[model samples]
Target: MRKGIIGDILHGEAAYIHDLRYQMKMKTGEGVWRPYHLAKRNGNLYPTHGLGPVAQYMNLARTDDQFNTIISYSTPAIGRNKYAKKISQRKTYGINRF
Candidate 1:
């Protein structure tokens, strides 16, 4: 029987989807990695960024199994607003107007 991580994934009947979220942080004076406005305007800030790895593991498009649809969702940018507020108060984020 198949064993190990890769083998388990290949032979498993079901799998779980888990990923680490990128916390928006200011890069010196370059502003935040994921701008709040862009995130709000676009449904998903990095829509396909995390899909490549999972797709490769699942062998999507390489085998009969393929991705048929995708549903995405996002929460309010409360954390971003809070972080911006804190940084702005410190007068360091270099964000005069956000």
Candidate 2:
């Protein structure tokens, strides 16, 4: 990630993607959407991972920073549901599974 920042500075507008996974353990019989657990899991106020630090390093916090904020604002739920359906169908038909 540091290398990506350096590349962006030396070059310009380099693109990168990072994947991160986390697991949450629920107490006995706890519902997945329980408010307390949800708050605990989602209460990170700062971005501890990825491009937050890089953007700071590039002085993006300043008023005169050139970059504009852009967002896709899309969730992967639809794609994930489609993929799961396809996999289930393949398994039911005895096709090769990924």
Candidate 3:
């Protein structure tokens, strides 16, 4: 079961935690567009942040445990779009395009 859990994580079986903590207020900063743009190109922006420790603990690629495959899913950016519309209406952040 433990091994399976680790495998699941390595195979992209977790939701991204960045949006949970990164509020719309934080997006108003000047340089905040970098991550948003990068995230646009990369489906999962922080896979290493979430998976690195697990892989290290499991000794993946160093021991018997290894990655067989990897998968990730990108949900619709509904929350972000809604928030962007609100911000755009206010013209507070200059995030018209989102």
Candidate 4:
């Protein structure tokens, strides 16, 4: 789980799938829909997780009165590319990555 691997993270993601399966009366080990982790190129992975709370607090005051702009930056994506390469290698070895 400590490694920056997609499969490792998805093993933990089973909790969310389990919850959904329970509501639908499906088995806990039911198969998942493919492409569940298909994130778009340069897109938000969980936009609502960040935006939902902010939208609910529209009246919140900012520390700087002249707050008219916001910006963000992301570091290089070595970790992500490495995970993709690992997944690719698994496919080449006929491994069940999920």
Candidate 5:
């Protein structure tokens, strides 16, 4: 018969270490969102920070492969509607909301 003890001794330690590391990162303040914005006309990706680990994740200056392209457009009429609401609110408050 094959010994089950042999397999447990070999693989158990590695499984325990992996779980410990994952838990530690979770306990510490390690993850947060970094904002990225794109202009209405230009299709470009803008990250708030550069260099180090974030750069590796975002893939800046090495390759453009990391970026997900987005396209957007707004007409003059859309601008007018936005402006109208702002003006109305501003007139009521006697100050600009933005």
Candidate 6:
């Protein structure tokens, strides 16, 4: 009786708790901030959040089923960046800095 794909997936949840709670000081901040602009562990390091569900739905545990390396993608920062540009474009602009 096969259980499922043999890959540990708790990393996504753990990273959420650790980064958002314990490491916000380093993860989130001001000054030319960009998320998808960089990668951790030398690669896109946040794909488990999406992979967990995909695997479950696909049932990658069949006798012939297979799983492979996870892939993460970078999102365009037009929204965030545009907000910053708007703030700076204000005549009375006075944003906080760190």
Q: Which lDDT tens digits does candidate 5 get at residues 1-98?
A: 02444342221111111112222112224311111111122222222222234444444456654435433332333443354355444222211222
C-alpha RMSD values across all candidates? 6.5, 10.5, 5.3, 15.2, 18.1, 9.8
Sorted by TM-score (best first), the order is 3, 1, 6, 4, 2, 5
Which tens-of-lDDT digit does each residue in 1-98 have in candidate 1? 22255454643233334321223345533245335344446356455566766676667778797879865566665555555666555433222334
| Candidate 1 displacement at residue 73 in angstroms | 1.1
Tens digits of per-residue lDDT, candidate 4, 1-98, equal: 23334332221111111122221221223322322333223433444455444433332233322325433334544554455455444331112222
lDDT of 2 by residue, 15-92 (tens): 344321111122223322332332333333233334456666666656477556544333333443444345444222
**lDDT for model 3:** 0.55
TM-score computed on alpha carbons, candidate 5: 0.17
Best by TM-score: 3
Q: Return the clash pairs for model 3, or none.
A: none
Worst 10 residues of 3 by lDDT: 88-97
Best by lDDT: 3
Q: In model 2, where do residues sit more than 4 Å from their true spots? A: 1-31, 34-49, 73-98
**Alpha-carbon error at 92 in model 2, in Å?**
22
> TM-scores across all candidates?
0.50, 0.30, 0.53, 0.31, 0.17, 0.36
Per-residue CA lDDT of model 6 for 34-63, tens digit only, reads 232321123345656555665555556554
Q: Judge candidate 6 against the unseen true structure and give its global Cα lDDT, from 0 to 1.
A: 0.38
- The pairs that clash in candidate 5 are none
**Comparison by TM-score, 3 against 5, better one:** 3
What candidate 1 gets wrong by more than 4 Å, as runs, is 1-36, 89-98
lDDT of each: 0.50, 0.38, 0.55, 0.32, 0.29, 0.38
Q: Of 2 and 3, which scores higher on TM-score?
A: 3
Please provide, for model 3 over 15-65, each residue's C-alpha lDDT reduced to its tens digit, 9 standing for 90 to 100: 447543243345556336643563355366566667776677656778787
Judge candidate 5 at residue 81 and give its lDDT: 39
Which ten contiguous residues of candidate 4 have the minimum total lDDT? 10-19
